[model samples]
Target: MADLWDGALIDAAIWHARTGDVARQFRYRALYAALPVDALEAAHLPLRPDRPGLWRLRRQDYGARDGSSLTDFIRSQLAPVGLSHCQITLVTMPCGLLHGFNPVSFWLARDDAGLRAVLAEVSNTFGESHLYLCRHPDKRVIAPGDRLSGEKLFHVSPFLPREGYYVFRFDPGPGRFGAWVDWFGKDGDLRLQTSMIGKARALTASALRRAALRHAFQPLRVTGLIHWQAVKLLLRGVRYRKKPPQLEIRRSEATAERSDV
Candidate 1:
């Protein structure tokens, strides 16, 4: 087993144990916290339907993150790793939008042969549908690339907005999460592929902890190499019976805005 895989599995276990997430929440939280407040504040909170053609809302607009209870807590977790920027997005659902990490999932890996074997094991052991391995939203793969290369929910969810999918990348080196696993690299403009998680924490913890202590929260910074943060956003949030502000985007326009046209 690769050291990176060991660290990834540990990282996965940590994710599951701490955040109840199978995906990369530590980095996600760091990324989100690192984002400039202005970028979030400036982006048309709630992203009301541009011209009032297709989308409608039951309430006024506000960025989901703005209303999030975790916003303040997330803001203050004292992240050891710092984030450069993370594009925050919101989608309007029948009731409310969903977040990927709300659903619990553990990490797995795909080295040279790919994670098909590991996923197959998951399906066999859990009685999970094999089709999910192909379509589940939480799956992610990291390798050298121009853009993330693998099965992405945005690719399948035709109803999602175009900007819904964004990838964060930088110069690759010893990263805050862990060093590169030789998992992949870019070739002639095409992104390559590989997958793994969990146990990564154990394998690379010493060096990563040392580096993190040395750099103090800076990403490894690579252009082609990637730190993929896969998540499985649950569909349950779409139900909006009780309302204390879920992720739903308010699309209802304000013709009643003080002065009408």
Candidate 2:
């Protein structure tokens, strides 16, 4: 695994493309933080946990979202599936200037054997979230080329129905990180494609300040962009799908069913 503890910045770009009824595509540069589950307790960094700082990573923003130990929450989910004793790194957006919102965050679990699993914590504007666990059925290392898939149980966009599956791919490296999530319909037709690809560098105090200067009020900007896109889609005459009832079980798991080079 890469030495992620040295820094916490992922200078990344996020993109989304829709190929369904309406054709829409967009990309934006975004900054993210990479924090190992163990490093959440470290207080030496400019970014601190559960407190106000220029950059903040609140434990209540993830996992159970109840101000619980995120590490323990990750372990509880993995232990039941025989995936304990693994290292976890959370790649997410931290609260910038005491205001934050993450549409999605990733919990990357790895063991001495190799990449074991990934928990994609996805949230929507409805103030709800869901967890999708992706791994291999035979407990094999999840290579970059692997395509792990799971059904779409939670409603994300009002323009799309709650029927489909997501194909997830990850490229984890020491100096860079990349991930792709493509949505497909019941007929196996591609609907949407989204990705976050970026370079990793040491996040010193200076670096944090630079990022702040570049992307100030990032959380609000992100939220506004989301609604702005929705309005665009609405103006484009895309039908709006109502949000469904909350899922009793807000978590789902998928096995790596195939690999494509």
How many backbone clashes does every candidate have? 35, 0
Candidate 2, after superposition: displacement of residue 86 in Å? 0.8
Give the per-residue lDDT of model 1 (tens digit) for 30-90.
Answer: 1111111223234332222322312122222222223443223222321211211221111
In order, candidate lDDTs are 0.21, 0.83
lDDT (Cα, tens digit) per residue for candidate 2, span 1-261: 235545568988999999979899988888998887776666656666787666678888888989988878999989988887888888898877746888899888888766788999999988899999999988788999889988889888899888878899987677878889999888888899999999888777798878877766788788889999999999999999888898798899867553331
Q: Candidate 1 overall Cα lDDT vs. reference?
A: 0.21
Give every collision pair in model 2: none
